[model samples]
Target: MFVLHIALQGCLRGGEVVFGLTADTGGHIRYLLDLVAASSQDVGVDRIVVATRLFHGAPGPDYAVPEERISDKVELVRLASASPAYRSKEAMHAEVESFARNLVAWIAAQPRPPDLIHAHYADAASVAGLVADRLGIPFVFTAHSLGRVKAAMLGPAAAGCPDLARRIAAEEAALARASLVIASSRDEAEVQYAGYAAYEPGRIRVLPPGSDLARFAAAEPRPQVDAAIDRFLHDPGKPTLLALARPVARKNLGALVRAYGESPELQARANLVLMAGTREDIDALDGDMAGTMREILVLIDCYDLYGRVAYPKTHRPEDVPAIYAHARARGGLFVNPALNEPFGLTLLEASAAGLPLVATDSGGPNDIVETCGNGLLVDPRAPEAIAAACLRILDEPGLYAACVAGGARAAAAYDWDRHAARYHTLLRALLAPEPPLATPRQLLVCDIDNTLVGCAAALGIFRRWRSRQAGLAFGVATGRSFHSAMAILEQQESPRPQVMITSVGSEIHHLDANGVTYTADAAWRARVSADWDRDGVRAALADLDGLVPQGSLEQRGHKLSYFGDAATAQAVRARLVRAGRRANVIHSHGRYLDVLPVAASKGTAVDHVRARYGLPERAVFVAGDSGNDVEMLRAQGHAIIVANYSDDLASQAGLTHSYVARASHARGIIEGVGHFRRMLADAG
Candidate 1:
C-alpha cells in the first residue's frame, strides 16, 4: 500500500541538487531515490512518499511548495520544522521533536495516511518513531551508519563531535521503537548493531542497497573524461589508481595519498587520481573538508609527489561510470580507503564497470570483496598494507585478470528491482492483518535472561500471575543448563514449568513439584545422539584459538558450551561442521556458542513438549532474547520476545506468529498474555 519514508536532513531529491549542498546530501540520498524509483515500478505498491525536513534561506533559496512529484507513483513532501534550511544533520537533530510534531500535523491532514513509515538514519528515526507512535503505524529504521560504531572507530576524535552521545541515544530510542531495522550487510547486522542492548538481529533485515546498473554499467570513457585523466598523467598510457568520495575525514584520503607516494613501484607504475568532490578553491572549504584537504596536501608535499598525483577539480554524477571506465581502459585499480564504510555503493559501480578494487578492510568492504571475489581488502590506517594490496593487483597478471572477471560476474546480483520486491513483501505482511483464532489454546514458551528477567519487580509480578493462571501451560526454553534454569525458578519462588527446554534445545526435561528432573523424549534423544561424537567434537575444538570452555554447571552431555565472540563462534561452527560431527552450532548474545545435534534445537524441543501435552500447534508459544532463541522464535508456534531481549534476537529474520512486547520480564509476559487473550476474544 502506501509508504512514508523519512530522510530528514538531506537535500531531498535528485533534481534539488540546485539547492546548496550539505554533508547529508550523499550516499543516503542516492539510496532512497533508487529504492523509491524501483518500488514505483512494482504494481503491488500503490503509492510511495518521501518526507523530509523543509529548508529555507540558510542552505539555499527556500522552495515554493511543500510537496513535489517525482513520478506518477512517487512524491516528495517537505515538512517545515522549527527553523528553516539547517545546514547539517546536527542542526536538524536539535529540532527533531518539533519536526516530528509538524510531520504528525501534516499526516493528520492527509486524505489517507500512509500504511508504514521507514526512517533513514538516526535523526530521521527519532522523528519517525515519535510520529509513528502517535499515529499508530509501524515504524521502520535504516541506520545508514550507527553512532556507537562510529564513536568507537573515531575514539578520542569522536568527543570533538559533541553530537555523538545524542546520536547514540537517538539510535537506542530508534532501535527500541522501530518495528524493523534495515541493515545493508550481514557484517552490519552481526557486528555494528551487536553492541546495542536493544538491537535485535531478528528485527534487522540485511538488504544491501542496490546500484543503478543502467547508469553504472560498463561504458567507453568520453573524450572530456579521458582528457580529465590525461591532464595530470605524464603518460596517458600508464595505468591509473582511482579514488572517489567526498573529502570527509573518515574517507582517509590522506592515507591513500601516502600509500601510493610511499612506494616507488606504485608511483612509477600507476598515476594516482583523486576525485574528492567539486572544488574551486581548497581554502574556501568548511572545517571538516578543509582539515582533510590539508592532510592530503601535506602528504603530497611530504612525499614530494606533485605531478605524479592528480586531484580533480570537479565531476558530475553522469560522469561517474565513464570515470570507472577510464580506469578500466588503462587497466587500473579503484580504491575506497574509508576508515569505516557502511556499504560501498561505488564498489558495485566500479565492479559493474569492470575495474578491480582495493578497499579498506572494514565494514561493507568485507562483504563486497567476499561476494564479488574481485578485491583485496587493506587496513586504511596502514599505508604499507595499502601499497602492498595495490602492488598485488598491479604486479600479478593472473590476479588482475581474475579480479576483473569476478567483478563483472558479481555485479549482476545487487539489483534494485530484487531488493524492492523483497522490501515490499515484508511490508505487505505487516500491512495484512491476521484473523483471530477461535481460542487461546496456543502455548507460549519464553526465554530467561534479558527476555524474562530484566526488571525484578515485573518478573515477580509475572511469577505470581503465572501461578494463578489455569487456562494455559508454560515452558522454559533457554540456553541455560537444567541446573542453572532450576536456580532461577527456585530463587524466584516461581511455579515449576511443565517443560524445560535447556542447554539451548540440546536437553529436554520435564518439571514437577518435587524438583527439576530430566524427562527424555526417547525418539528425540535417539535422533539427537545418532551421529554425535562428543569426544571427537571436543578434540576438534581443542585447538581453536578463541573458544574457551564454560564452567561445569553451564555445560551438558548433549550440548558443548563455549564462551566466544561472533568471529570465534563462526570459526568454531565451521570447524565442527568440517570435522563431520552431526552437530548444529548457535551463537547468541554475541558471546556464547553451543554445539548440539542437528535434530536437537529449542524449536524441536518445544515441539516435542507440545506433542507430549497433545496441545494444538496454534496453542504453542515460544520465546527467547538472544541468538540461541531465534530458532524457537521462528518456529510454527506463537512466540513472544520479552522487552529487554538482546538486539541480536530482534533483528533476526523470518519470524512469523511472534509478538515482541514493550514491557520487560514478567511485565512482558503479562503484555503477551493480554495480546493472546485479545486474539481469542476477537474470534468469539
Candidate 2:
C-alpha cells in the first residue's frame, strides 16, 4: 500500500539529519525518518512519499530541493508553500492552505494516489486533513508534542505566546478530523489527549515508536567527541550528567543547571555536560532557544560552576552516539529534565548506549523507565528532587549495575521492525473495502468466560472450525468490560472477533479494519441511553436489602453492577419501577446483579447486531450457559444451551426451542451451530 507522510515544520531530508539546525528541526524529524525507513521494509508497503514544505534559507540548500529519493520504495517530496524562507512550527499555520493545495495537486499527478496519509505534528495534521477532505482519503494523526501539553508545562510563560492558542486550535481540528491517532506512550494517549475537546479514547491508540539504537548500543567514545566535552570539565574522569536537547525553555535545561549547581555532593559526584544544540553563536539564536541558552549560562556562572560543567557549543549528527558512549564509559547518567516530554526518544538512545537515565516524571518517561527499568523519574520543576535522584544513582553501585542491565533491554523493547509490521497491518485494514462486520453472511455471538473459554481442548477445536467458515463473523457478548473481555481473549489466543458487546450489552465495540483496535458503536450507545436514568436507578436501589455496590471496574455508564442475590435483584427492579425509572435488572449465579438500560440486555444487543448486518433470524446464532444468557438465548431462533449451563437457563421461559447440546463449553457451541445449520439445510 502507498503511504504519504506529511511533516511541514522541519528541515526534513534523507541521510545525516542535522538536528538542532532549526528550532523546529528536532526529535520529530528523527521519528519520521526512522518510521518511514522501517515502513519501506514491509512487503505490503509498495511506496512511501515523505511530504514536507519546500523552503530556501539559513538551515541549508538541501531543504530547497523539491524531491530526493531515499530508497527504492521511499522518496522525500517537498511542496512549495506560500513562503520560501524557513518557518518555525508556530509560523506553519500561515502556510497551511498553500501547502495543502500543493500537496493535493502533487498527489493528483502521482501514478496512483496513496492508500493512506500519515500526518506528523499539528501543522502537518491540519494540512493533511485538508488534503484528505479534498481527495477523499483517510489520514492518521501523530501529534509528536501537543500544544496544550506544552502550554500547561510552560504555565504563566505560555500566556504571553499568542501562537500557542492557534496551535492548540489546529490540534483540536486534527483530532476531530483524523481517522486514527497514534500515540507514543500511555501518558500521551490517556493523560495528555484526555484534556482535548475532541478527545476519544477509543480512536486513540498507544503504539510506541521504535528507535534504531544498534549504533548507540555498540558505540565507542571517539577522541573528537570526548575532547569537545572534556575540555570544559575540571575532572573529565568523574561520572558525567549529560543533558542532550535543543536549547529551549520547555526542555528545562536551566533547571538541570540549577539542580547541578545547588548541590555540592552532586557536583562532586558527576560533571555536568550540556549538549544543548549546535550554536555557532548563542546571541544569533532566535527567541526561546537564545533565552534558554543565556539562562543556562547565567545559572552556571551564578553558582560558580565553571570548571565542573561542560556546555558544548556544537557536535555533528554522527557524534551523538559517541556522546552517549562517552557518558556511559565514565559511568554517567543521561538526564532529560524537559518540562513535558511527549516521547523520550533520547532516553531510549541513552539506555541503548548503556547510560542510565534521570528523566522527568511529567510524560513519556513514565512508560520508558517502567519498561526499561533503567532510570529514576524526578519532578523537573523541583531542582532539589533532580539533584537527589542523581545522587542516589551515583552513590549506589548495586543500583547503578541494575540500571545498566535494564538499559540493555531498550534495543529489543523498542524495535522498528515490530512497529512497522503492526503499522502495516493497521494500514491494510484501513484500506479494506469493507470491515469484517459489514459483509458477513452470518454471525456467531458467544459468551466469553464459561461458554467459549472454559475448555482449552474444546476451544482449540472450535478455533480451527471457526477459521474454516469464510462467511461467518464471530463475536463475543460478555458481561465483562471491553478491556476485560479483550484481555481474556488475547490470553487464550482465541480467534480475533469482529464484534464485542461488552458491559452486559450497554457498550458495543466493533473491530476496525486494522483488526487490532476497536471503534465504539455510537448508535447503539444512543439507543440504550434513551429513557435510561442511571443516577435515578442507583438512588432508588441504594438502600435495598442484601445489595452492595460492586467495585469501580464493574460499574459502567450504562450498567450498574452489584454483589447481590436473586432476591436483591428483584428488590432493585421493584424499587426502580416504583421510582418511575426504567432499567433492566439481571441476576446471575444467584449472586451477581447488573442494572442496565431498559433497552439494553444480552438478547436485545444480539438482535441489534443481527439487524445491523441485515442477517435473518435463521442466519444469527447465539450460545450461552447462564442466567445473563437467558435473554440472548430466547432472543434468537438459533440459540445454544451448553451442557454445563447454569441458573436453569435451559428451563427458562421462551427458550424451549433453543438447542441443548450434549457437549460442554466450546464443544457445545460447535455442536449447537452444526445442529442449527442442518435444520436450516433441511428446511431449504
Candidate 3:
C-alpha cells in the first residue's frame, strides 16, 4: 500500500539532517525520517512519500528542490506554498490554504492517490484534512507537540496570542477529523489531549516512536569530540552533566545552568557541558534563541561558573553520538530540564550511550523512565530538585549501577521494526473496505429521555418494529453520557442502536463489530472542535450572575453544564460575545443550560453521521422533545416532535417544517418514520 506523510515545519531532506538549523527544526524531523526508514522495510508498504514545503534562500539549497528519491520504495516531494522563503510553524498558517490547493493539484496529477495520508503537526494536519476531504480519502494525525498544552505551560500571557489560539484550533480540528491519532506516549495521549474540546480517549492510540540508537550504544569517545567540549572547561576530567537541546526558552537550559551554578556540591562533583544548537553568532540568532543564550551566559557569569561550565556554540549532527560517548566515558549523567517534552528521543540516545538521566517530570520522561528504569524524574521549575537528583545519582554507587543496567533495556524496549509492524496493521485496517450489507442506507435517530423512553409499552412496540427494518441504521442522540444513555436503553429494553451521539452532540461513538464495544468517532470530534475556545468560554462566564455551575460529572471537554433559566442563557450568550468567544448556548427545561462549540449540536452531528454513511438528507429521520433538541429538530431532514415534547418545543420558531406526531414517546418515533416513508413513496 502507498502511504503519504506530510510534515511542513523545518528543513527536512534525505541524508545528514542538520538539526537546530532553525528553531522549528528539532526532534520531529528526526522522528519522521526514522519512521519513514522503518516503514520502507515493511513488506505491506509498497511506496512511501514524504511531503514538505519547498522554500529557497538561506539555511541551504536542499530545501528548494521539489523532489528527491531517497530509496527504491521511498521518495520526497516538496510543494510550494504562498512563500518561497523558510517559515516557522507559527508562520505556516498563512501558507495553509495555498499549500492545500497546491497539494491537491499535485495529488490529482499523480498516477494513483495514496491509500492514507499521515499528517505530522497541526499545520500539516490542516492541509491534510482539506486534501482528504476533497479527494474522499482518509488521513491520520500525529501531534508532535500540542498547542493548548504549550499555551498552558507558557502561562496566562499565552491566552492573548492570536497565533497560539489559531494553532490550538488547528489541533482541535486534527483530533476531530483524523481517521486515527498517533501519540508518542501515554502522557501525550491521556493528559495533553484531554485538555482539548475535541478530545476522545478511545480514538487516540499511544504508539511509542522507535529510536535509532545503534550508533550511540556502540559509540566510543574520540579526541576531536572531547576537544570540542573540553576547550571551554577549566577541568575537563570531572564527571560531566550534559544538556543537548535547541537554544529556546522552553528547553529550560538556563534553569539547568542555574541549578549547577547555585549548588557548590554539584559544581565540585561534575563539569556542566551544554551543547545548545549550532550557532554562528549569538546576536544573529532569532529573538527567543538569542535571549536564551544571553540568559545562560549571564547566569554562568553571575555565579562565577566560568571555569566549571562549557557552552559550545556549534556541533555537526555526526558529533552528537560521540559527544554522548564522551560524557558516558566520564561517568556523567544526561539532563533534560525542558518545561515540557513531547517525546524525549534524546533520552533514549543518552540511555543507549550508557549515561543515566535526570529529565523533567512533565511529559514523555514519565513513561520513558517508568519503562526503562534508567532515570530520575524532576520538576523542571525547581532548580533545587534538578540539582538534588543529579547529586543523588553521583553520590550513590548501587543506584548508578542499576541505572546503567536499565539503560541496556532501552534498545529492546523501543525497536523501529516493531513500531513499523504495528503502524502497518493500523493503516491496513483503516484502508479496508466495508461489506455492502454492513453499510447503512438509512438512519433513524431519536432523543432518549422523553422521545424514546417515557412509556415502557411504547418502547416494546418500537423495538419490535425496529427489528424488522432492513438497511436502516438505528441510533440515539442525547445530552447524556454514553454509559448513562446505554444504561437507560438496556433497562428499558430499547433496541440496540448502531450509533450513539452523547454529551449533547459533543461526542459520537459507533458499535464495534463485536457488538459489545463502541469506538469513538475521531472525525466528528475534529469537526465540532473548529474555533472552539473552552477556556475562553469558562473565563467569560466565570462571574456571570444568574448561572450556577453544575456538578463535576456534568462537565465535559466539549460541553459545560449549568443551572440557569432563559434570561441567564441570554446573559451567557451576550457575555461570550463581549469576550469574543465562539460557543453554542442551549437552555432546556427552564432549569438546565449547556454551552458547546459553535460547530457542535445534535443537528450538525446527525448531518455528519448521515453524510458518513452515504445516506441522502431525505433518507434520515430525527425525533426530539426539548429546547436543546431545537437545532436537530429544525434540520433539513425529516423531523419529528413527540406529543410529549417539553419547553414548548412545538411552537419553537423555524420548526414549522417538522411533523407534529399524534403519538408520544417511542410510539411517536415509529409514527414519524412511517409518515416520512409514506411521504417519500407519494413523492416517487
Candidate 4:
C-alpha cells in the first residue's frame, strides 16, 4: 500500500535530516522522518512519500530539489507555494489554497494517485483535505496543536497568529471531511475535537508517536553532551532541571523560568537549563521566539538568577541524547511546563534516557505520566506546582530511582519499530474492503454546563455505555461559543458530538475529519443584523446596576452577553423589548443573560438539526439543567432534568414527556437515558 505523509512547514533538507539540528525543526519533523524510516522496513508498505512545502534560500540549496530519494522505498516530494521567500506557518495560511491546487496538479500528472493521504499539522491538513477531496482518496489528519485550543489559552493577546478565525474554520473543515484522525493521545482525540458537530468518536484512533530508542537508550552516555552542559553551568555537579523546546508562548518557558526564580529550595537544589534556540543575541531573534526570549531574560535579571540558569542558543542534533545523559548523570530531571501539550515526544526521549520527569498535567503529559509512571504532573500555569513537582524528584533518592526504572519500562512501548508495526496493521485493515457499518440513527442531545461534566463517576460510566452501545449518537447544546464549549468538553473526555448548538443556538456546525462546516441560517443572520444596533444596546445597558459585558469569547455574531442577577436580566430584557428590538433574551444560571436573534433558540436549532439528520421523535433524547436548556428539554418529547437543576427548569413541570432525574450531572444523564430506553422498550 502506498501512503502519502504531508508536512508543509519548516526548512527541508536531505542527507543527515537531523531532527533537532535547529529549534525550529522540532519533534514533528523527527516523528515524520522516523516513521518513514521504520515504515520502509515494513513489508506491507510498498512506497512512502514525504510531501512538504518548499522554501527559497536560507537553510541551503539542497531545499531547491523537486524530489529526493531518501532510500529505495522512501522519497521526499517538495511542492512550492505562491511566494518564494520562506515564512512561518502562520504566515503561510493564505497561500495554502494555491498550494493545494499545485499539489493536486502534480498528483494528477503522476502514474496513479496515492492510496491514502495523511496530513500533519493544521496547514498540511488544510492542503491535504483539498487534495484528497479532489482525487477521491481517504484523508487523515494529525493536528499537532489546535488553533481553537491555542486561541482559548492565549485569548486576544495572542501574537503571530492574526487569522485565528481562518485557522479554526480550516481545522473544523478538515476534521469534518477526513476519513480518519490520528491522535497521539486520548486527550487529543476526545477533548480537542469536542466542539465540532460532525465529530464521530469512532473515527479517531489513538496512536502515540515514537522516539528513536536506539539513540536514547540508558546504556549510551555521551561525553560531548556532558561537556556541552559543563560549559554552561556554574557547577556541573548540581542536580539539573532541563527544559528543551522552542521558545514559543504555548510552551510556557517564561512560567518555568518564574517557577525556578520563585523557589529558593528549587534554586538551592538544582540548576535550570533551557536549550531554547541557536541565537545568542536576544535582539537578533524575531517573532514568537524573540518575545519568549525577552520575557525569559527579564525574569532572569529580575530574579538575580545569573549563573543559576543556563540557556544555550545552539546545539547539534547528536547532542540531544548526551544532553539527556548529562541530566541523568547529575541525578536531575526533565521538566515540560507547556500550557498544553499535544503530545510530549521529548518526555519519551528523556524517559528512554533514564531521566526522571516533572511535566504539566495537560494533554500528552497525562498519558505519558500514566504510561511511564516515572513523573509527577502539575499545572504548568502555576509556579508553585511546577516547583513542587521538580523538588520531589530532586530531593528523594528512592522516588528518583523508581522514576528512572518506570521511565525505562515505559519507553519500550514508544520505539519507532512498534509504532510502525501498529501503523502497518491499521493501514492494512483500512485498505481492506469491507461492508460499511450502519450509522447511529438515535441521538442524545445534551447541554455541557453543569450537566455533562463535573461528575467524574457518571462521565466514566457514560463513556463505558457509549463504547458498548454502537447505535446511539451523542451531541452537546450550550450557550457557549464554539471555542468555549470545546474547552470545557475537552476536559470531560466524553464522546464527540455529531452536532453543536453554540452561541445560544445562533450557530450550527456539522463536523467531519476534514474540518468544521458551518450550517448557515442566512435569513436568521439577516433578521438579527438588520436592526440590531450593538453600540446602542451597549450604551443603553452601560449604566445598569448589576450587569457587566461578557468576555470576548462569549460575544458572537448574533449574540450579546452580560453577567447579571435575575433582577438585572429582567430589567435588560424588558428595556430591550420596550425599545422594539428584535431579540430573544435568555437568563441562565442566574448570572448569564444572552440577547440573541429572535429567530434562534436551542429548540429551533434542535428542530433544524433533527430535520437535517432525519431522526425520529422517539429516537431523540434532550437533557439539561439551566434555563437556557429549558427550551430544548421541552422541545423534545423525550426530555430530562437533573435533581440539581435550577428552579427555572423545575418550573417547567407541566412539560410533556419530561423526566426529572434523582442523580445530578452525568449521573442525571445516565438516569435520563435509562428512562427513555425503558419507554422505547415498552412501546416496541
Candidate 5:
C-alpha cells in the first residue's frame, strides 16, 4: 500500500523495550532487563514487548510453568514450539535470518516503527542490528557479558572455542554496527567490549541504570517495623541498623549478621534487622524456598543472639520506603557487605529511600555512596571496619544525623521524571523521519459526455486520438459506471486515461499500467450528482409519444436532435422553449429540449471538454446553432453558429463573431474542431 505521512502526524515521546524471558535465563538478559526497566521508570517509556517461551523454564505450549506477569504496559508474545534454542549453533544462525525477515515485515506494518532499537545480548542485538541497517534506523547495544569479560568473571562459560567462538563473533558483528553502545559499568565495557580497536570510543557511553528516589521516599512504610524492632531491641529510642542482600555467597550477608551479633551498641539495645527472606513473590530460579529458608535459619542459630535480631520476610516492594523511613526515624543504618559486587540496586534503593547507607568500597556502591553522600563507605572484607561503622551509626548521634541529612538531600536530586526526559531526548536524537510516500497535490478533471465521446462519434475518436497526442494527460469524470464507462474507454481508438472518475459523482480511480489501482472522490462530480437533474424531463420523456431515451444518461449527450431538415428541428425547439414555466428549454441539436442544470449547457460541456483536453480555460470554439448552443456560443463568444440555425438563436448567441456554416450536423462538428485547433496553433 502506498500511504502518505503528511508531516505533523507522526511523532512519539517514549522508547520501547523488546526482550526474551524464561526462569533460569537470568544471564546477560537480566542485567539488560534490569537497566532497561529502571531506565524506563526513570524515563516515561510508553510500552514494552517481551517475547516469551511457552513457560518460564520451558519452550512449548504444553509446558506446566504458570503465566508470568510483568508491567501493565508490557505485552508478551509466546514463542512457538518450533522456535530454536539460543544455545544451539546451527539453529541460532537460521533463527536469526528467519526472525530478522519477519521482524522487518512487522516493523513496516506498524503505523510507525521504533525510533531506536536497543536490544540486549548478542543474539537479540544481531537480529535488531540486521533490520536497523536494512531499514536505515539507528540501534543501541548494551553488552552486559561479553565472552572475554565472562571468561575472566565466570570462567569456563566465557572460553572462546568452536561454538563459543562463533557466538562471540556474532556479538562483535552487532557491536560494530551499533550506533551507540551502553555499558552497565566501565569495567564491563573495558573488559568485554573494548578489545575491538575498531569500536568507536565516542559512540560508547557509560550509563548506569538509575533508580527512582521519589517512589522510595513515598514508599509504604513497614507498619510492623516498630512492633518487630520493639520486641527485639533493648533500648527502644536508640538507633537501629538494617541489612539487605540475596542469600548468596557473594552477597556476604553472613559477615554482616555476625557483626550485628557482636556490635556493642547492637548487643546493648539497638536491634539488628535483616531481610531474612523477601516475600518478593517472585519464584526463585531453583524453586527451593524451603532449602533457602533453612540456610538463613542456620546463620541465625550460629549467632545465638537471635532474640536481638528480627526476621522480616513478609516484605512487599511497597513497604520498602516505610522500612527506610522507619529506620531513619530510629536513626537506622543500611549495611551492604557484598564481596566484589558489580553494581547493587539495593544500595541505590536504600540511598533513594533516605536511609544512611553503609556499603563496601570496592564496586558500584563506591560510586553511589560517595556520589550521593548518603552513606559511610568501608571495605566489606574488613570485618572490623564493618563492625565499627555499624557501632558509630548506632552510637554517634552527631555523625548519624549528618548521614541522614545527606541521604535526604541526595534522594531529592534523583527524580524519575528527569531520567525519563533525558532518555526520551536520546531516543528522539536517534530516530529519523520516515521517508515521504505521498505525491504533490494538484487536481485534473475531464469531460466524459460530449468531449471525450458522446455516443459513438465522441468515444470512437478517443483511442486513435490519445495515441496521436501523448503529452496531454487524461482524466475521465463522467456520469458513467466503472463497468460500462471503462468498456467505452477501452473501445476508444486512444490510450486510456490514467485517472478515471466513473459513476460520475461516486468514485475516482487512479489506473496505472502496473496493474495498480486506487479509488478516491471526484469532489466536483459528487456535488453535481446531488444538485443536477437526475430523473429529469428525460425520464418523463419515456411517457411521452415519440420521446425516447437516448444519451449516456439515456437521452442525454445527443439530446432529441431532430433528424429531418433544419427548419423542422428549429420549429420543434421553439415549441418546447415556449412552454417553459421556470426557464426556457434549450436545444443545441435544434430539435432537443435538454432540461439541464441552470448553469449547464453545451458551454458547460465545452468547458468540461477543454478541461478534458487540458486546454487553457479561455480556449474554446463551437459549431452548434440553436438555443442549447447559446451557452457554448456565449462561452466561445466568437464561435460559428451554423447558417442553418434560426435567426432567434443567432441574436441570443451575440452573433458579433458568428460564422455561417455552409454545412450542419457531423460536418459542422468537424469544422468547429478544425477551427479551434487552428486558433490554438496560431496563438502558439
Candidate 6:
C-alpha cells in the first residue's frame, strides 16, 4: 500500500488523483481503466479526478465519468468549463490554445486540491505538473508515445495539439521532480531516457503493463469463436491464427495479410483473422490510424486474398481471452506483428489465455517473445519470411507446443498485486516527512501614511489642495481623532479645519463595521505640542497672535482638543520653530501640519495588526521610504531602504547589508517579499 509518510498529524484528510484523458477510443481508454483498477488497492488514493477537455464534437460532461463508476474508493473531481475551437485546420490551433488557457485556469481553481495527478500524455502532464508545483503536489507523466513519433505520424495535425510542446518540456521537468516514472517497459525507458535531463538510469525500472491472469484463465471456451474456426479448415487441417488490435497501420496489419497471402502451406491449412476496431467516421480516416488502416485494406484488396482473411467487430479487452481460446483449441497461432510496440500488453494477455504465439523481431515484442520462449520472429515487411516462419511453427507440432508452454511461464511477471505494491513504495518514499504547521497567533501594527503609501499625510493630494487639510500633523500608528487636534494642525496653511489628530497616533475604528470605536489621546498629545519648561511646558506660543490658531474643535469620540485657528496655528508653528522648539510634526494633507505624541509610532501599530492575523512577532518586518518612518524602521525586525528612501533616514539606519536589494517602489516590494520567503524556506 502507498502509505502517507509525512502528513498533518492531526489532519487525516482525503486525497484525489487528477488523471488526464484526451481520447476514449483505442488502447488509451483501456490503459486508463487498467491503471485506476490497479491503484485502487493503495490506501492513500481516496479519489480520482478525470481531467478532461471536450473533443471530436462530443458534448462534455460527456468526457467526464461519474464518481460512482470509479468504485467506492475514488471520488471524481471534474475540472471542465468552456472549451476551445476545433475542426478547421487553420483555426484548430487557435481553438486548442483557447482550450488550454481555460483548462489551466480550471485546474488552478480546484477547491480541495489533488494530492497528485497522473497525466496520460506530455501535454496534459505539463499543465498538471505546473499546477502541482505551484500548489506543492506531485505530478506524474505517462507519454504513450514520444513527441518525435507523434509529430512524424500526425504531421501538420500535431502542431494543433495545445500541450504538445509544453508536454515535452514538462515531462523532462516532472522526471526530475516526480517521485518516480512508471516505465511500462525497459524499451520505453531506453528510447525516452536520453531525451530527459538528469534522468537516473536506475530510476527507470522495467515494470510492464498490468494484467489480470486469473480473469483470463477463467474465460469459458466459446462456441461462437469455435464455429468461425471450423469453416477455414482444408483437406489437411492447419492451425488457426488470430491477431487483435486497432487496425491502425502501425499495428502492421497489411504486412500480416500479405504474409498470410504468400504462404500457401500455412494458407491452405489455416485461416488468418485480423480485427482492427470499428470507427463511426469514414472522414476520421484522414487521421493516422484511420489512414494507416485504409492503406492496409487497400493492399489486402489489391492482393485478391479474400477467402482466407476475416475481419471481426471490436471486442472488449477483457473478452479477448475467449477469442484466443477458440483459436488455440483448434491448434491456432496468436500473432502480433507491431512495428514500434511499447510493452506488448496484448501479447501478455495472449500468454494468460494459454495460446501459442508468433511475434515480430522488434521493440517490446522482442522482450515478450524472447522472455516467454514463444514462437519465431520474421521480418514483417517480407511476406516470404513471414509465411515461412508461420509454416515452420504449424508443420512441427513440438515447436508450437513449446511456444504455448513458454507463454504460460512468461505471464508470471506482470501480476497486478505486485505492481500495486511497488507503486505504494514509490509514493511513500516521496512523501515520507513534512514540516508541522505553526500556530496562528500574531498581529501587525502599522503606520498609515508614508509607511503604507508614500505620502506626507494619511489623506493624499485632493484633500490637501482644497485647504481642508490639518496642521500640527501626525504620521504614526495611532488612530487618534482629527477633530481634537484639527485647529492646531491646520494653523500651518490657510486651510479651515474639520478633521482631527485621530489618523495616526490614537484612533482605532472600523469604518465598515463599528464606526469610531476609539478616541485620540488628546491631553498627552498636547503636552508634546509646545515648549519644554518647568511648568510641564504649556503651549509656549499658545496665546501668540502672529502664530497659527486652533481650528474648530469637534467631539472626537470622547476627547476634547484645542485645535489652532488658521492665523494662530500658522503663527504658533513658525514662532515655535524659531524658538528651537519644533513640534514633532507630521504634515498631513499638504494644508495641515499635525503634531503627535512622541511615544506613539507606525511600528507600534504593526504589532497589533500582526497579532490580529496570528502571525509571529519575530517574523514581522517593516519598510518605508521616508524620514517620517524612522520609528517604524527601528521597530521592525528587518528594515529595507529603497533607492528613493529619505537620505536622512537611510543615513541614520545602516541597512546596506547584502540582504538589501537594489530596487525601488513596486519592484522593491516584490523582491523584498521573495527574499523573505526564501529565508523562511532556508530556515526550514
lDDT agreement with native, every candidate: 0.77, 0.88, 0.88, 0.77, 0.50, 0.50
TM-scores for all predictions: 0.68, 0.75, 0.67, 0.64, 0.47, 0.53
Error of 6 at 493 (Å): 84
Which structure is stronger by TM-score: 2 or 5?
2
Candidate 3 residues 29-101, lDDT tens each?
9999899999999887899999999999978799999999999999999999999999988889999999999
- List, residue by residue over 1-684, the lDDT tens digit for candidate 4: 889988876766545554333334666787788788888998778888888777667555777788999999899988888886666666768778888998898888878788888888878888887886687878778878887788879776655556776778778887887777777775676676766665655556677788776678744557766666677668778988999988878889999999999999999999999987567566655457778888998999999998888887677776788888878878889999999898998898898888888897768787778777889988888999999989988778899988988888765666677677766655665666322213657878888878888787888887888677667767788997665565356445666566767888877655543232223444445644666677666666778788888744356657889998889888987787677666778888888898877777887787777776687888888889888987788788989888778856876655656898999988898898899899889989
lDDT of 2 at 602: 88
Candidate 2 residue pairs in backbone clash: 429-513
In candidate 4 the C-alpha lDDT for residue 528 amounts to 46
- Which candidate should be chosen as best, given TM-score against the real structure? 2
Question: What range of 10 consecutive residues in model 5 has the weakest lDDT sum?
Answer: 4-13
- Candidate 6 accuracy as TM-score: 0.53
What's the C-alpha lDDT at position 326 in model 1?
A: 88
lDDT of 3: 0.88
Query: Once model 2 is optimally superposed onto the true structure by TM-score, how far is the C-alpha of residue 578 displaced, in angstroms?
Result: 26
RMSD of model 2, in Å?
7.2
What shift in Å separates residue 474 of candidate 4 from its native position after superposition? 21
Model 1 worst lDDT window (10 residues) = 433-442
Model 6: lDDT to the true structure: 0.50
**In model 4, where is the ten-residue run with the lowest total lDDT?**
513-522
Off by over 4 Å in 3: 433-684
